[model samples]
Target: MSDTGRRSRILQAAIADGLLHPQRAPLAAFMDWERVTSNVQHLMHAFPSHLTTLHAFAVKANSLVPVLTRLRELGMGAEVASNGELTAALRAGFAPERIVFDSPAKSWQELRRALELGVSLNIDNFQELERVRQILSETPSTSEIGIRLNPQVGTGGIAAMSTAGVHSKFGVPLDDPGMREQLIAAYLENPWLRRAHTHVGSQGCPLPLIARGVNELVRFADEVNLRAGFAQVRTLDIGGGLPVDFETDAPIAAFDEYVAELHEGASRLFSGDYAIVTEFGRSILAKHGFIAAYVEYTKQVGGRDIAITHAGAQIATRTVFMPEAWPLRIEGFTESGEAKPTGTAVVQDVAGPCCFAGDLVARGRELPRLVPGDIVTLLDTGAYYASNPFAYNSLPVPGVYGVSMAAGARPEFSVVREAQLDLELTAVATE
Candidate 1:
């Protein structure tokens, strides 16, 4: 389908699924799962044979059960960062081999659980490797593992999110000759080590920068094959940093372009066979969903306009606080319930109802003349927004909804999870 036509239809499906709620709930968030699943399918089709093993959706991006279930059904794998994520993945029906467990500071129990379950574990440190060894010895399971190697390449949308480069705390530094030697020796000694992976972080990643990182990964894989004397590494996870629509006019990373580039890089860097795997979180789901917020009140302060909405940084902290901003498109509705074409005009700040003065959603930005009860759409928030929400000031988690659209079929949408409330009652009133 044409891009415009597809977007329109998806929007229509979202509205039908209640994704476009007229106002935000007291403590509810919503998602368009059908659009997200379809996007995944589209990506898989776009890459076809070039993509291997499977694309694992990063659970940290959005761990809503419905999202996980949809991805599980889509034949995509699960990339988990904690025991909760692992449990969530399993609960959503993801197989052991189809799930990737990667975290910098994993607990001993978590490691043991991963070993017991035969999940794909990505080891991040020598200490963690030792823990894995201890766990395997006790469990005696022939588990597959991957080593996360940080190339120190430095690529990210914001400095905080970038996992690559000199200052990163993630993965063993691939450039450190001594560290590389240690990793290889450890891998050679451990029978469970099966794959090598790296992620430079997410958001606003320049395409060329990621292409370079992929080349580095392929080269590192080649080195592992030659130095470690291992052949046919089953997986080479390049790590997910595919850019989502966050401010600027930066176009979405072309899946074909990236895969083709990566494939060519791999062919040049290695002779051993491997599956090119990616653990995409944001890019896969972000653009496919949004958060609908109702303006609670509006005020003019010091010659600046502030439209306060129920949606706040608590739900989408990254986009609001991170140096990188997500796309924010505001649609104005008149009291007559008629849509108004308010050019590209902008507003100063969109505030949330939080205790702290710093609690804001989108700031120093442009939006329409928003008033109380109008809806403000936070576009491309499907990835990390709702999934990583913060209840810093005791805000309740939001509700999530799912929607589906297929060829020659009616659109389908439903509330996957209800909006939860934070009932802080001092006493139950014993009687």
Candidate 2:
């Protein structure tokens, strides 16, 4: 079946099962489990046979416990950036050895907990390294330690997503005076620092630029090993930023293209001298998921049609705030979950429920005329949409589900997370 047909069937089944309300303007996120698994397999195939790669799914992209659990089952490790993400990984049954703890501002307690768990650590800055050193003084650890490097690579399409920019706050800048010497001395002084990590950028980052950053990381590692007289850095965590094909029904990320680019630009990385780790967040799950919401009302303003939907800044925070950087495809459907008839295409602005004027998902786009009770499906939303919802207006978090379909078999759906109540803290409130 085509993507549209499968989505229609899943939405119809969700409505029939009472998981989605046809008339209540409810919002829900859905993931194609088969597509997700297929993407993982494709990612695994991109690596060379001689190199050992651990594809750690970045939990910040989609923190749904069931989603993490499923990724773990597919032989993927978890890359957590916060205490909450660490807890989620643990709850999802990811082993400590399979988890990488990385955060720019890891608190004392968070660092302590991570050390106690013996998870891999990618120290962000000198202050963070000091904190880790202090923790190790009190309690010895067996965690794989690494230092994040800002290769000072050129910026990507989005400044905010660029991690290796000259002024980026993510990692220690290698271009700074005495910074390289400091890093080498740190590695020599601490034999436990056996890994090196660098994430060039995310989303809009170019493949060659990302590869260049990885090449710089490899060169740095080689230098450290040469200076230390042994292989002090045995692993390279080339952070993931493989962009998804939002324009097409691509089932997986562009792993083949990305790997080819890396091979061309950073051939040394494939030499098989070091274990490789990837912290891919968006590319792994972005294209496999989407958000479906009801159009509550329609209006005409300044001679242009408008659709007011239950999805806006709450679920599509980046799109609403940065539309150009994160443009999402919108598909219209009738109230009964069938694809809307193709008629005269009208320029409409899809607005969300947020009170601010900037809460629009797509503006000035040519989409079929949307009416009240119609469904609007936001395509390619699996990664950062509902999973990273904005709490503006105290909106409730939408429920998420995983849908799996096999050839000549009935589709199976499992709820990944329940919809949050209007006031989730009501039970704990003592008034």
Candidate 3:
């Protein structure tokens, strides 16, 4: 609740002063810089017991330079998944060591580039580990190495994001007997190995799942260090998967509570020597962003009210493209006053302007009587929506604006990326 008033003021300002590009009216998404920074500050205060060496913000969440720059100013690091994200991190002023490279299928060229920059590499699998070994053996020493471990906890917003589950394709599983010993042996044999890491899942809500993963990870880390007989382990990277409050009034997981539990779990197993690192992607940036799109049209389908929005699965696929879900409502912008809630009280199915029959955002839920030009603000669109857009349909992507929760703040967002242009050949009418 810190700076709650400031957050409101900044959000109001964004609705008032943000400049939309030509043809990109009624901005699609806006990031609240102040609120995001405040979240970071809250996290820093929460984990006072541990040397939080690097609160690396996941770049894949929102790779916008303004977003990255704002996070950098808050003394946060960057967790990049690809060479392009690494480039964005560097451009945004992250130190080489502050950048953590993670990917299951990285090209040798990308690995070489990161190594050359001295960034930390979180090797995904044994094959990638051997690839690193071969590359580093030949090339001059460049990058520090870390291994990503899968606690196999199986939790997240959706099955697709659940990386720690038994069937996950991420990090080497720690539960398997002798797997820990093998990984430790690999690290002991490799001089570049200095860090061990793991991520349970993304968009995780329940804190207990995270605690389980961390506790188990600490046991694994302790075993690795004891077996190696060397204090080469300086970093324990518990990858980020903090959730954000969308349209629901329900409370999101407190940043401090999560950190405290994680710290306690780590403390129960290991002493005070290594830095406890967290890569928070969505929770750090999601709440601070809002997606404001105009209501396109209204229809009565199946005896229900359906309001189509300008933003579709092309922009927010996870939320909109699903087996029907309801997003939390933070605010409503319309010309009418206190419209009657006559529609179904349940979660309504809101569809986007896609041709697919299954393009409904939400289904069979109650929403206010809507009309064209009314604005709908998707509560938390800052994380994966903008950067991880679906390029299947050539729908015109809307403009993104960055807002600060500070006084006298103006629109300061650049095109983190341009939307893909639609091209179709039709017979031209001769003038």
Candidate 4:
């Protein structure tokens, strides 16, 4: 069956099997296991056999325990940015050695935990490096450490998603006066600082800009190694910001294109001198997941059609907050979960259930005329949508299910998370 047909069938079966309740309106985020596995395999194949590459999934994208568990099972590692994410990775059974802790504002307690657990960490600033030094003096432990560098290669389409912008707050600015010399000094001071990391940006970043940023990182590492007269840095953490094609039905991100760009822009990257580490969050899981919501109402205002769905600011926080930067495709379906027939399309705004007027998933998009009780599937939401929900109206968190399908067999679905209940929300406060 075609991709659309197959997805429709899965939704239909989910409804029939009582996995989704139309009354609840917004239900579950569905993950395609097979597609996720294929994407992982494609990334693994892109690297040469001599290079040891760790494709660490950024836990900030989708911190669902089951998702992390599956990624670990696929020989992937975890790149956590917070203590909660580190906890999630550990609970998901990721080995301490396979986890890399990265955060600009990590607390002393968090740093102590990381050191005790023996997970790799990236120091964000010179002050943070001093903190690590203090910790080592007090309680020394074997933990791989690195410094994050900002190549200052220009910003991407979205300024918010740009990590290497002129005024970006992420790694140490490499172009700052005397900053490059200071960074090298830090590495020379601490031989344990054996890794280098750089993440240019994410959704809006261009391929060439990303390549340029990584090339700078490789060059910085090379200089550090040469100046120190020792191969202190053995790994390069080229952070992941591979943009996904939201306008297409492609189930995978452009992994091959990204690798080719890196190879061409930074030929020294694959010299078998250093192992590679990647912190890919969105590109790995974004295309393999989607959100299915119920259209609760339809209205016409000033000659424009509007669909009020259950997937507004709660699930699609970015799309609602910054519509242009995070536009999502909304596919309309009949009340029975079948695809709506092609007809004279109308420009419709898919609004969420939040009280605010800005809680819209899509604005002025042409789609089939939506009606009450219709199903509206939000495409390409696998990464940040459901996993990063905003409790604006205290709406219950939706359930998420991992679905697997084999040829000539029934589709199997397992609950990766359960739908939150009203009482469950208050239970914590009462306790």
Candidate 5:
């Protein structure tokens, strides 16, 4: 079935099951389980089985425990940046060895904990490496410690999203004067540093840009090992930056193109000598998830039709704050979950239920006229929309459902996360 058809049925089933209500629960997120499973399966098979590749899901993308648990079940590892993400990974049943600890501002306590747990570590800077060295002197850890390298590969389309820019604050700059010698010396001096890491950017980064960054990482690893007089850098964490297609449901093609680019630009990725780690977050979950909000009211402002929905900065923070960078495809559905008739295309604004004037998700877009009691869906939003919600207007975090829309099967909705209460401190045990 087409993505739109499947989405309509899933929401229809959700409404029938009372998981989505126009009055009581105006906002709810849905993730297609089959689509997510298919995505993971393709990635698992993208490389040869002989090549050691740890596909670690970046926990920052969707921090929900239920989502993490499902990912863990699919034989995917966790790439955690913050201590809270680490805890969430553990709670979701990720093995210690399968978790990778990476963060620019990791506390000493966080480093010690990860080391003790035997999780991999990517030290962001020299100061963090010194602390790790000190900790190792007192207590030996089996952890594979590495340094994050800034490849200076230049920026992608989004300036703020680029992490490998010349002035990026992510990792050690390689192109800076004297830095190559300094980095090689650091690796040679520290035998514990057996890995090198680089994540150029997210979303806006293209496959070619990502491949270039990986090529730099592999080259640096070869240089470091050559200087160390042995295979010192045995692992490479080529951070995930496979851009997703927000315009349509096109994730599998992106991954296929990504593998092709890696083969062309970074063939060393498949070399049998080193183990590979990938921290893909958005690409894994974005295409399979969507946000549905009930349009509470309609109005005409400056001779333009407007739809005020329950979705806004609370659920779609990026869209509300940076609409141009994060443009969302808004679809209209009836209160009963059927597609709203597109008889006449009306150019109008789709506003969210936020007090701010800048909460419009779509500006002067041609779409079916949305009315009160209609549902407005934000497509391709599984990774960051509802999962990375803002506390603006003190809006409650909407419940998220894992939907099964298999062929010839009835649509089913399983609770991935329950709606958050105002005073609730602990997460709901949905899994």
Candidate 6:
């Protein structure tokens, strides 16, 4: 079945199963578990299985423990950026060895704990490296440590998202005056630095551009190993930036093209010379999930139709604030959850429940004419949308359900997280 048809049926089933009631519960999120599994399988096979690779799912994308636990079960490790995410990965049953600790501003306490836990660490700067040296002096650690290098190949389409630029605060710039030699010397002085990492950017980054940046990393690693007269860098954490297709229901992100481009630009990366690590997040989950919210009211304002929904800055923070960069596709559904026909299209503004005038997910979007009690779903939101809820007006975090439906079978909902009730229940569920 077509992905659109399957999602239509899933939404209808969710409403019939009493998952979203206009009166009781007006908003919720649903993840296509089958689609998530398929995406993970695709990632697992994107590279040759004979190669040593760790496809670490970026926990910041969807930090829900249940989802992280499922990824762990699927043999994907966790790439955590903060203490909370690290704890979530641990609670999800990820072994210390499988988790990769990465952060630009990791606290001293966080560093100490990560060293004690023995997870792999990607040191962000020379200052952090000095701190790690101090910590190692007091206590021996099993963590495979590495330094993040900004190849500074150039910026992607989105300047803000680009992290490999010369002045990007993410990693030590290799192109800066005398910086490249200093980095090589750092590695030579500290033999424990065994990995090299680089992430150009995420969305708006072309695959060729990413491969170009990684090619610089390969050259630097080759020189480092040659200078050391051995393979000092055992692993290459080629950070993930495979962009997702938000405008269409693409079966999966362009993993095939991404690998092909990498081979063309950095062939040695796939020559099995060093172990590989990927930290993909959005591409893995974005296309497989969506947010469903009931339209509370509709009004004709300034000769334009307006739809007030429970989704806004509170859920889709980026879309509401930076719609140009993160525009989302909105589809209208009947109160019964059946997709509204496109013939009823009307240019309208989908407004959220927030008080600010700028809190809009879609402005002048030509969607089916919506009415009170109708549903509006934001597609391609599984990664940052539902998991990164914004607390506005004391709005409770919506429940997240993992939905699965077999062919010719009804949909089943697994509670990834329950909606925030009173003090008796919180936004994040404990399971």
Task: Score every model by TM-score.
Answer: 0.86, 0.97, 0.86, 0.97, 0.96, 0.97
Model 2 spans with C-alpha error above 4 angstroms: 23-25, 424-431
Model 5 C-alpha lDDT per residue in residues 199-286, reported as the tens digit of each score: 9999898788889999999999998887788998999999887888899777463667788899999998788878999999999999
Flag the better candidate by lDDT, 2 or 3.
2
Off by over 4 Å in 1: 1-28, 48-51, 228-232, 247-253, 264-266, 269-272, 323-327, 334-338, 343-346, 405-412, 422-431
lDDT scores of the candidates, listed in order? 0.70, 0.91, 0.70, 0.89, 0.89, 0.90
Structure candidate 5, residue pairs in collision: none
* Candidate closest to the true structure, highest lDDT: 2
Q: Can you write out model 6's per-residue Cα lDDT over 1-431, one digit (the tens) per residue? A: 76666767878887887778886668899999888898898888898777999999999999999999999988899999999999999999999989999999998999999999999999999999999999999999999899899999988888888998878999899999999999999999999899999989989889989999889888899999999999999899999889888888886778888998998999989878889999999998999889999999999987989999988899999999889999999888889878888997989999999999999999999998999999999999999998999988777788899998887898899999887653334433443
Candidate 3 regions with alpha-carbon error over 4 angstroms:
1-27, 49-52, 154-157, 247-253, 323-331, 335-348, 405-431
Which 10 consecutive residues of model 1 have the lowest summed lDDT? 422-431
Tell me the tens digit of each residue's lDDT in model 1 across 1-431: 54334434545555555544454353344455555655677668755464355788899988878788888888889999998999899999998988888999999988888888888888998999888887777678645788898878775657777788786889898787587678777766764677888887787666666767767777766766687675735678878877775442222435666666655654442333777667888878777666666677888999888988777778878656652455454444433224434684666687777776766766777655787766566666677777677877777677776655667676566666666645543133332
lDDT tens string, model 2, 323-383? Answer: 9989999988887789876686788999999999999999998888999988899999999
Poorest lDDT segment (10 consecutive residues) of candidate 2 = 422-431
Q: Any runs in candidate 4 off by more than 4 Å, and if so which?
A: 423-431
Candidate 4: tens digits of C-alpha lDDT, residues 290-376 = 899888888898987889988888899998989889988878877677988758688899998999888888888989888888888
Local error of candidate 6 at residue 193 (angstroms): 0.9
What's the lDDT of the predicted structure labeled candidate 2?
0.91
Compared with the true structure, model 2 gives a TM-score of 0.97
